[model samples]
Target: MKKVIVLISTYNGENFIREQMDSILMQQDVEIEIHVSDDNSRDNTVNIIKSEYSDKISNLNINKIGTGAAAKNFLQQLMRLSESDTFDYVALSDQDDIWNPRKMIAAVEALEKSNSKMYASNLTIWNNSDNSTQLFKKDFPQKKYDYLFEGGSAGCTYVLTRDIVLELQQIIKNIDYSEWPNFSHDWLLYFLVRNLNEKVFIDGNPYINYRIHDQNVHGHMNTLSVKMIKERTKLFFNGWYHHHALHYKKLLQSNSLEYKILDNFTKSYFSRMGVLLKYNFQLMRDNKKFLMFFFFTMINFKTPKDV
Candidate 1:
C-alpha cells in the first residue's frame, strides 16, 4: 500500500472536526498518517481529537501551537515535513470538509497516470444554510498566467508528489516569511509549482465535499454579489494584488519573460499598457475575468504599499 501523509489545519472547528476526521480515516487503498495543526482553538477541537482519534489513528501527530493563521499553520507543518521522507504523497486538508473513500487513491492514480508532480481537483460545494450543493468546476484549460491571478482550486483538494513537496520545501526555505504578504498558501504553492515548470494535473472530477459555513476563512465567490464586488474592489484599490505581484517578481528569474511582464505590470499604468495589449486575454481563465483584470490594472495607479 502507498503511504500518504495528510496535513490538516484547524481553527475553532469543533462542530465538524469529527466528521472530517472520520472521512479522512475512512480513505481506501492507502496507508494514512495524519498530522494536524490546531490554531489554539478556545473550543474543544484539540480535546476532541486527542480523546477520540488518538487511539483510532495510529500515527496521529497533533500540534496545537499555531500562529492563528491557516496559511502559516499549513506552511509550518510543510516546513517540518521537509526533513522527513516517510510518505509517497502529501495532501492538504481543511478541518471542515469531508473526503470520499477514494480521494487519496484517486489522487495517487491520477498522478501516476498523468506523470504529473502536483494535482488539484474540482469539488462539490455544500452550503450549510440552504443545504444546497453545487459542483465547483476548476478544470478550465489553464492559461499562461493564471497562477499569477488565482489558484487552480482549493487547497483541501490538493495532492502533491513527494518530489514536488521537497521542491516546495526548498522554495519555502528561501522565502522571508516576515516579509511575505498574506497570500493564500494554496495560491502561493500553485505559483511556485508553475514557476518551476512542473506539470500539474487538474482533475475535473471531485472527491470531496467542501462544506461552507459561517466560520470559513475563505468561502465560495462564484456568485457576483454586491458584497463580493465591494470586497474585491477594496482588495484592488488597497494594493493587495500589486503587493503580491511585486513580491512574486523577486522570486522569478530576472531575465525570464514572466519576470519582465510582471515587472512592467508593476510599473505605472502606462508601463502596464504593453502587457495589457499583448497578454490581456491570456492572463485569465476566460474573457470575462480578463476584462475585470484589464479594468483594475488600467485604473490602479497607486504605488504598491510596503509590506
Candidate 2:
C-alpha cells in the first residue's frame, strides 16, 4: 500500500470542511495522511479542526496571502519535510469539496497500474442552490498534442507521483505556478508536465464533489456581465499572450529545440492566428521597447509620426 499525503489547501471554509474531512476519513483502502494548509482563515476553521480532529491533521498557516501564494508556501513546507523522507504521492485538495471514499485508493491504483507520473479524474459538480449535480468528464482528444492545446482541466482532480511532485516543487520554486496569469495552478502543472513529455493519464471517475458557490473567485468570474466579459476577455488575451511569449522566449534563450517545438506546435492554430499574432506583437513591443525605438531611429520618416 502506498502512503499518500492528502494536501488540502483552504481558506475560510468552515461551512463545508467537516463534510470534506468526513468523506476523506471514511476511505477504506490504503494508508492515508492528511495535511491542511490553511490560508490564515478568519473564521472558526482552525479551531474546529483542532477541537474535532486533534492531532490527526497537520496545518500550515498562510495568514493574509493570496491563494497562489498560500499554495506555494505550503508546498515549500512540504519540501522541507521531504528532505528526510518521501511520500508515495501528493494529492491536491480544496477545503470546500467532498471526496468520495474511493478517491484516494482509485487514484493510487490508476497511477501504479499505468506507471503514470500524474493522474486526474472526473468530478461531480454540485450546485449550491438547487442541490443539482453533474459529472464533469473531459472528452479530450486521443492524441497528447490535442489535449495540450485544448487545455481546460479541473484542478482539484490532480494526483502526482513522488518524482513528478518533487520536480514540480523545483520548477515552482522558480516559476511559481500560482501566479501564471489568471491560470489555475492545475493548468500550469498540466502544461508544464506535458511540456516535459511526462507520463500523464486521466481516469474516468467522479470521485470528488466540486462545490460551486458565489464566493469562489474563478467560479464567480465565469458569470460576469457582457461588459465585464469584454474587459476580462481583453485581460485574459493580454495575460495569455504575454505568458506564451515569455514561455517561448525562455525556450529560445535556453536554445532547446525540444522546448521550441513544444511551444510552437502546441500553439499552431489557424483560426486563432490573427488574435494571437496581435497579442504576441503587443507583448513583444511591451517587453522590447528598444527594438521599437531602433526601428524608428533607423527608418526614414514614413508619414508624419503620430505627434
Candidate 3:
C-alpha cells in the first residue's frame, strides 16, 4: 500500500470540513494522513476538524498560523517539513473540495505509468451559487514556459512523488526570499519542475469535486469570448500579469534562450508599433497584436497547452 500525506490549507471552511474529511477517509488503496494548516480561521474550522477526523486519520496535525492567503499557508507547511521516506507521495488538498474515492489511486497510477515526478488531474468544477457543474478537463501539452504564464496544474489537484517532494524541500532550504513570487505556489512549482526538465503528468480524468463559491481563491469560471478576452487583458495589465511579466523580464535575462524569447516578446507586445526596434527583438517580433492576444489569453485563461 502506498502511503500519501495530504497537505491542506483552511481559512473558514467549517460547514464543509466534515464532509470533505469523510470523502478523504473513504479513499481506497492507500494509507492517507492529513496535515492541515488553519490560517487563524475565525469560525469553528479547527474544532470541526478535530471532532470529525482527529481519531480517524492516521496522522493528523492541525496548526494555527497567522491569517494569510492560501499560497503562504501551503508554502509554510511545505517548508517546515523535513525530507523523509515516511510517505511515497504528497498530495495537496483544499478545505473545501470532495475527493473521489479513486483520486489518490489514479494519481499514483498515473505517476508510475508516466515515470514522472508529479501528477495532477482535471477537476469537476461545482459552482455552488448557480448549482452548475462542468469538467475542467484538458490534457497536458508538455511545453516549456507553459507553467510561467499559465499555471499548468491546479494546486489542489497536485500529488508529488518522493523525488519531487525532496526537490521542493531543498528549494525551500536554500530559497531566495527576494526572488519569490508573492502569490501562487502552484505556478512557482511548475517553473521549478520545468527548469529541472522533470517529466510532469497531468491526467484528463476529473477526480475531485472542486467547489466554486464566492470565496474561491482563483478557480472562477469565465467564458472565452472576445469581450471576456478584453476583460482578462485588463486584468493582466492590472496585477498578476504585470507583476509576473516584470519578474520574468528580470528572471529571463539570466535564464535559457527560450526565456529570452519570452522577454523580448513581452516588451514588444506591450508596445504599440515602435518599441519593437528598441527591444532587439527577434523570433516572434512581428504580429505583436496577435502575440498579445495569445499571451494574454494563455496567461489569463487555460488552454490545452497549459501543463
Clashes of each: 0, 0, 0
Question: How does candidate 1 fare on TM-score?
Answer: 0.93
Ranking by lDDT: 1, 3, 2
TM-score of 3: 0.80
Decide which is better by TM-score, 2 or 3: 3
lDDT scores for all predictions?
0.83, 0.61, 0.68
Tens-place lDDT digits, model 3, residues 74-117 = 87777756665488988888888899999999999999998998
Poorest 10 consecutive residues of model 2 by lDDT?
A: 298-307
**TM-scores for the candidates:** 0.93, 0.74, 0.80
Flag regions of model 1 displaced more than 4 Å.
58-65, 220-224
Candidate 3, superposed: residue stretches over 4 Å from native = 58-67, 176-182, 221-234, 245-255, 265-307
User: Rank order by TM-score, top first?
Assistant: 1, 3, 2
List the RMSD of every prediction in angstroms: 2.0, 9.0, 6.2
TM-score of 2: 0.74
lDDT of 3: 0.68
